[model samples]
Target: MASNAFRKELYVFERGPEGKPVMAVIRNYTERDFDGLIRIQQESFPPPFPSELWWTKEQLANHVHLFPEGALCVEIDGEPAASITGLVVDFDPSHAEHTWEEITDAGYIRNHKPDGNTLYIVDVSVRPMYRKLGLGKWLMQSMYEVVVQLKLERLLGGGRLPGYHEHADTMTAVQYAEAVLAGELRDPVMSFLLRCGRTPVKLVAGYLEDEDSLNYAMLMEWKNPFIR
Candidate 1:
């Protein structure tokens, strides 16, 4: 955590002329534009899910204020173009063994443990059509503001990672975790974070399973005080 004064500041710039990107502070989940959010999620993800699974207005309203402090949305010309969702949850080192669902519901942060000191970035997705325009960087900067405001010491959770166990039919979870963490291959999400001045705090061993699965976990924490 940095100085409270430094953390509370906001940095604004015109991203475009007529289509200026609006950096809307997301206070409640209902304020999240589900249509745009779902589009970005689907376009950025494989094994695309039905829109109804996540895009319902009821779901948004139900969880909108749960993490109201850290959620944010980036709008383009009055339309939501990108969104970043996170929370100031306690981090439990023991939860490393927990399933994603378990972590999602009863994880360290959700349980309000005293040892949970890190900020949890749940989802950071930008529309595929809006890639390479610095929107991701902008959203990340916004996330920094939220973290600084909460005075959190570290960040944790599964960021985007490389494809898993592509060539192998069966492999140990530890082996797959090592491959991704050791940089056996390039990961676009990790690369993006690095480019935006974020570095890994720890690459947890046995953090992910490798069994013809496509998703792998990437745990990164912000080191610098100012990514604003």
Candidate 2:
């Protein structure tokens, strides 16, 4: 449990439907946040996907070291509930055709270029218990804040199609993605990205080794409204 003093100091309070106060805090990731972030990743992404898919302490530390301002997290009641990790990269349309490993350089974020024009979102995770609370949107807004501060051209990322596994046998990844975009289907990640003003550019196959998404992901981009 979060200490009352810590909670009071860090969290922002809002009234719940029952008139009780709900606490939410959004902040940057720190080295000490490793354990909490790993736990959130574990709970958020389950089995059939190797544990290696999750970031190690060293990797998380490296991300913070390389791009401290790009890592953001949301804490609810003083516990880590969600996070978004990003890296700066020069925008390349060909990137939409690359696998996750190629795009992120195997999650080492070595492709992070300080002078890059685009902010590439590497991953976003929210604990199952905290889903549907608009926390994802809050995190995206935080990412946008970083984009504006950096004067980046856009935000880009691969949106996982967790709902793809069920429809994989019947349709191609692009077809499924088109359906989701057309409102004929709802994908947990893609739908949220669309709602946040992201446009799906293409469906990249084998983007990740996750069985749930059948290894397919949507390449999505959100142009910075402040860029113009």
Candidate 3:
């Protein structure tokens, strides 16, 4: 849960389809927000992914302890509707493609490097009811703010293709990613990342056990525009 002293909010107003302004409150995660975060994760990601993949209280605590400023949540009607979590890491091309466990060290976040050049995104989730409101992009924009504040060179993460299971028998993960990039196919997550100017760096096998992604994930990166 977040400490009352550290709780702060940023109001974001977006034009709805009818030209009405939709208001959302973006704020940092608090210790009290853990259950809501976990609930959102469960609702956002369905079966074939065990509960272990969800952010445990311990993991959340570790993240907050290591970098409290790296986690942010978007609240709607006083409930957490979306959230983003990340950690700073030194970039290493030689070890660019790492599994989720390898990158997060089993969700302990012991690898966070304050002086690192990369902001490695560990997780980003939005409630199912809030999908079409452009909240995901808002969460991402907030992440860019974190990158700038930390003076990082880039943002990196393994993007899951929740729709990949449907194409597993027909195409490889790499092929699917290329097709999505070429505008031939649409993916809930990958397409959004591409639209945000993130580039796919590589295909990582066994990134997670999610059957939807066929156990494969795309290594994606977005370079910091503010940094040369």
Q: TM-score of predicted model 2?
A: 0.86
**How accurate locally, in lDDT, is each candidate?**
0.54, 0.81, 0.82
Q: Which stretches of candidate 2 lie over 4 Å from their true place?
A: 1-21
- Estimate, for each residue in 50-167, the C-alpha lDDT of model 2 and write its tens digit: 7888889988987888887888888887678889889998877764587878768787897789999989988888888777566788788778878887789999998889998899
TM-score of 3: 0.88
| Each model's Cα RMSD | 6.2, 4.9, 2.9
lDDT for model 3 comes to: 0.82
Regions more than 4 Å wrong, model 3 = 1-16, 46-48
Query: TM-scores of all models?
Result: 0.66, 0.86, 0.88
Clash totals, every prediction: 4, 0, 5
Question: Higher lDDT: candidate 1 or 3?
Answer: 3
The candidate that achieves the highest lDDT relative to the unseen native structure: 3
Best TM-score goes to which candidate? Answer: 3
- Writing each residue's lDDT as its tens digit, candidate 1 over 1-228 gives 112212222333444654543344332223436666667677766464444434344434433545555456666555666776665565655554434434444222253333346666666777776664577777777676666666677655565455444533565544654554577754566667766667655444334443334545556667436433
| lDDT, candidate 3, 24-129, per-residue tens | 7887887899999999999987775677788899998887788887788888888899998888888786777678887877777889988888988888888888
Better of 1 and 3 by TM-score: 3
